[model samples]
Target: MSGPKYLGHLNINVRNVEISHEWYTDLLGLHTYDFIPGRAAFLSANVELSHEIALTQVAEGAPGLQPGQVGLGHFAWRVETLDDLKEFYQKLLDRDIKITPRDHGVSMGLYFQDPDGNGVEVYYERVRADWYTQENIFTNEKRPVGDFPGPWDELAAD
Candidate 1:
C-alpha cells in the first residue's frame, strides 16, 4: 500500500563534469560531499539523503544535450519499499503503461518514457544498510532491471 514519497534527486548529464559541478554548486550554493573524481559528484544542500543533485559526465561519443532537443536524462521519485515498487509496477501495467524496471545498484528503478517520449524513472531506493555500508556508498554500475513476477497475470507490451 506504500507509494512514491517525494522527489529524491535529479541526475543531470553534462559534457564537462568539472565545469557543471562548479556551475551548479556556485549557482545553488551546494556543497560536494562525495565524488568519483571527474565522472560524477553527489552534491548536497544538506538534505536527508547523501545528496540532492547527481551530476554525471556525459557518455563518451554522445552528443551534448541541448535545451528542447535535450530530454532531462531522467527524473526520479522514490518509493518507500520494494513492495511499493512491485505494486506500482503492476498498477502501471494494469493501466497498460510501458515501463522498464531496473536495479540501479543503489536503487531499484523503473525507467519509462512519457507520452511525449521523455524518459522518466520511478524508483525504490535500497535501504541504505541493506545496499552498502557508510564507507562505500555510491556506484554507477549498470545492471539490468530485476525480473519480478507481477501480481497481475497480464504482462505489459514492450
Candidate 2:
C-alpha cells in the first residue's frame, strides 16, 4: 500500500516549554508564533510557512525519552546551507547540548538531545540525486566527526 498523505507538523511532549522553546529556536532557527501557558506552544520558520513544530507539556512525573524506545526515534529538519548546520552545531555545543555528528552517505547531520533528552537531528543533504544508485544505499555508517567536509568554507570565500 502507498503511504498516506505528507507529514504535517510534529507535536512533541517536552519537559519544559521555555527551555525547549529556546533550545529549538537557537539550534534550528525557528521563531515562536504562538504560546499557550501550561498547555502548548507553536513555532515556525522565519519564512511564510506555517507552524513547523509544536510543543506540549507532558504530565508531571512522566518518564522522558530513553534509548531503544518503542516510538518516535527522531526527526530531521533539512537545512539549505551547510554553514547553517555548522553554525548551529557550534551554538548547541556552547549550550552544553550533547551532540553526535555523523555523515550519512547522502547527508551530513548533527544529532543532539533536547532539554528533555529527545533526540533531534539537523542535517544538510550533501549528495546530488544523480549520485544515488540501487547498489549504494546511504547507510548510517559511523565515521569520525569533521571527516565530512562541509561546504561552508567554499561558500564563505565567494
Candidate 3:
C-alpha cells in the first residue's frame, strides 16, 4: 500500500484566532484563505492550497507550550534563496523580534515565536547539488544571530 504523498497541513491552537491571524500573515507572509473572526482561521503560503495552517482559538489565558512539552516543537518553511533569508532577517531585526539562528550545514534558518508562543522557523536551504554528497547529508550547528551576509550593508549606507 502507498502512504501519503506529502505532509498536508498543520492545525494549531491559539489564544485568539484574529490575533494569531495577524501575526502569521504579517511576520511569515502567509496569506489567509479564510477567517472566522475570533474562532478560527486558515492560512497558506501557496495560493493553490486551501490552507497549510489552521488556527483554532482556545481560551484567552490558555497555557502555552513549554520548552519540554511533548507536543509540537515548531513548524518550518523553506525559502528559495539566501538573499530572501537575509531580507527576512532584516525584517525581524527592524521589528525587534528576538530570534535564534541555526545552521544545518545545508541550510540556515531563523527561529522565533508568534504572539501566542508558537515556535516558527523560516529558512533557506542550499541547492542539493551545492551541499549534498554521497557520504554526508546533514550537520547541525548553532549560528550566531546577525551573521547573515548580504546587501544589507549597502542598503544601510544608502
Candidate 4:
C-alpha cells in the first residue's frame, strides 16, 4: 500500500512539559509556539505547516519510557541526505545525545533518546532499487549499518 503524502505530527506525553518543549525546539532548530505555561505546548519545524509535534506534560513522578513496555515503538525524522543525517548525528553527539546506529538494508538509522528516555530515530535512505526486496517492497532487514562516520560507527560498519 502507498503511504500518505507525508507524516504530519505526533502527540506525546512527556515527563515534564516545559523540559520536553525546550528539548524538541532545540532539536528541531525551531521555537515553541502556542505554548501554555504548563500542561501542553505545540512545536513546528516550519512556519507553513501546523504543529509538527504536540507535547503534553505527564503527571509528576510517573515512570519514564520503558523499552520493553508495549506502547509507541518510536518516532522518526528523515533528513535531507547522508550529509544531513551526519550533521544531525554530530549535533546530537555534541549535545551528548547517545546514538545507536542500524542498517535496515533500505535505510540507515540512529536510535537515541530524549530527556524522558523516549526513543527517537534519525535516519537516511540509501539507493531504492538496490534495497527493494523481491516481495515488491522495501526490505525490512534489521542489520548492522554502513560505513562513513556516525555515533556507532565501530559496530555499524561491521
Candidate 5:
C-alpha cells in the first residue's frame, strides 16, 4: 500500500511576515528554520525538518476572512497529554487570546485565531481505545472532562 504518510507542511498568507513570524514562533514555540525579511519565513517545532509552516507576506490592509467564508477552516496541532493541554491553555490565557474549548469525546481542544485571523486548534487526544474503535471513531458526544482548567470547566457538566 502506497500512500501519503502525514502532512509535511503548511503555507499561509499573512499581512506581514515579520509580525506573523514572531506571532507563530512565540505562540507555537516553533523556531525559525529560514527567513526572508518582509517576505516569508519558515518555522518548525523540529529543527530536523526544514519547516513545518511557511508564512508568506501579503499586502498590508488586506481584508481578513469573513464569517461563513468558504475556505480553509483551520489547522490543528496535537499535544501529548492532559497536562500539556493545560499548559497550553494557560499560555493562551497569558497571551490574552480568546478560546473556544470543546470535548470531542476522544479529545479535548482549544480553538483560537492568529494575527491574521487564521484559525488554529490545539488538542490533546485521549487513549487510543477511546477513539480508535470502529463504532466510536468519531464522536461528538459531550463528555465530562475531569480536572479541566479555566473555561474548560464548563465541559464538566456535559
Candidate 6:
C-alpha cells in the first residue's frame, strides 16, 4: 500500500498565545479555526491545509527568547511585484512596524519584526527560474531604489 507524506504544520511557542494569535490573524490575514483557551491556537491560511501556524502559550514565568538561539530563524511571504512590495513597505511604516528593505539580485525583500520580535520577511522575486544566474547571487550589500532600475516605469506612464 502507498503511504501518505507531507510537511505538516509549524508550531511556535509564544509568550502569550492569545496576543500572538491575534497578531498573526490580523497581520498575515490567517483565520483561527481552532483554539484551546490558555493553551494553544491553530490558524489556517485556507480551508484546505490543516493549519499553517500553531501557537502554544508558554507557562507563566517562562523565559523569553534569547538572541542567537538555535531554532526557527525566519519565514517569508512572496509578493508578485516590486510595486506591491513598495505599497506594503509604506503600509508597514505607517503601522510603525520595524522594517528593513533589501534588493536581493533575484528578489526584493522587506524584513520586519512581529509583536514577539520574530523575524518575518515579505518579498517579491525579480526573476523567474529561467532568468536566474550564477553570477548574480544576491548579496547583503545595499542598493537603494534610486540606484537601480525598476521594471514598471513604462507601465506607470499610462
lDDT of 6 by residue, 1-158 (tens): 97768556778887788888888887777888898888999987666877877888887667765789987787777777878777767667667787766655577777887767677788888666633454545443442342224543333333
List clash counts for every candidate, in order: 0, 0, 0, 0, 0, 0
Candidates' TM-scores?
0.44, 0.77, 0.86, 0.78, 0.85, 0.73
- Overall lDDT per candidate, in order of appearance: 0.64, 0.74, 0.82, 0.75, 0.83, 0.72
Candidate 5 minimal-lDDT segment of 10 residues:
140-149
- Residue 4 deviation, candidate 6, in Å? 10
Indicate the TM-score of model 4: 0.78
Candidate 1 stretches with Cα past 4 Å from truth are 1-71, 132-158
> Which regions of candidate 4 deviate over 4 angstroms?
1-7, 130-158
On TM-score, the stronger of 2 and 5 is 5
Give RMSD (Å) of candidate 4 vs. truth: 4.3
> Ranking under lDDT, best-scoring first?
5, 3, 4, 2, 6, 1
**Model 6 lDDT, residue 62, Cα:** 71
Instruction: For residue 18, give model 3's deviation from the true position in Å.
Output: 1.0
The prediction achieving the highest TM-score against the true structure is 3
lDDT minimum window of 10 residues, candidate 3:
139-148
Between candidates 3 and 5, the one scoring higher on TM-score is: 3
lDDT, model 5, position 128:
72
lDDT by residue (tens digit), candidate 5, 7-96: 999999999999899999988999898899989999988899999899999998899999899998999989988878888887888788
Who wins the lDDT comparison? 5
Candidate 2 per-residue lDDT, tens place, 1-158, comes to 98878666899998778777887877677988888877788988745656888999877567987678898888888888877787767676667777777766567888877878777888887657633443445442432335355554453344
Cand. 1 TM to true fold: 0.44
Clashing pairs in 5: none
Candidate 3 lDDT for residue 108? 83
Consecutive 10-residue window with the lowest summed lDDT within model 2: 136-145
